[model samples]
Target: MRLANRVRELRARFRLSQHELAEQIEVSRQTIALIERGDYSPSVVIALKMAQLFKEPVEMIFYLEEEQQ
Candidate 1:
């Protein structure tokens, strides 16, 4: 399974920069960039923090994609 997210979209909707979101979540901007690029999967704690900040459900922000078999 692959992890996917709508971090960029949500961040834009909230008028937040990557740095701003990272600060709110206590992560580095690079981490936010990685997450936005789908190059990294956040820990549960971080994911929860982001969901709360965006006022979105965790499933709405992050989800797993089943690989086609």
Candidate 2:
């Protein structure tokens, strides 16, 4: 299974740039970019941080995607 997220959508909703979000979350801009592109899976702490920052639940921001059979 892979993790999927709505980081890009939510970030846009809040009108925050990747750099801005990264600073708010205390991560690198590249990390935010990777998460948005689904290239990297965030840790639980990171997910929670994102959830808190966006005022959203972690489940709403991230979910498990079953692999194709």
Candidate 3:
């Protein structure tokens, strides 16, 4: 299984640019981009920061999915 997320969608919903979100979440823009692309998984602290900024639960932002074979 692979981890999936709605970071991009929620970021758009909030009308936040990757740079803006990264500032708010105390991460690099590249980190935000990576997370949005599902190329990187964030640590718990970072996840919680994003959840707080987006006013969402961590579970609502990230979840598990079957990996493509």
- Which candidate has the top score in lDDT? 1
> For residues 1-69, what per-residue lDDT tens digits would candidate 2 score against the true structure?
988899999999999999999999999999999998899998989999999999999999999899788
Clashing pairs in model 2? none
Indicate the worst ten consecutive residues by lDDT in candidate 2: 60-69
Better of 1 and 2 by lDDT: 1
Give candidate 3's whole-model lDDT. Answer: 0.93
Candidate 2, residue 57: the lDDT equals 95
> In order, what lDDT does every prediction score?
0.95, 0.95, 0.93
- Which one is best on TM-score? 3
Q: Quote model 3's TM-score.
A: 0.96
List ranges where model 3 is wrong by over 4 Å: none
lDDT per residue (tens digit) for residues 1-69 in model 1? 999999999999999999999999999999999999999999999999998999999999999888679
Query: Candidate 3: minimum summed lDDT over ten consecutive residues — where?
Result: 18-27
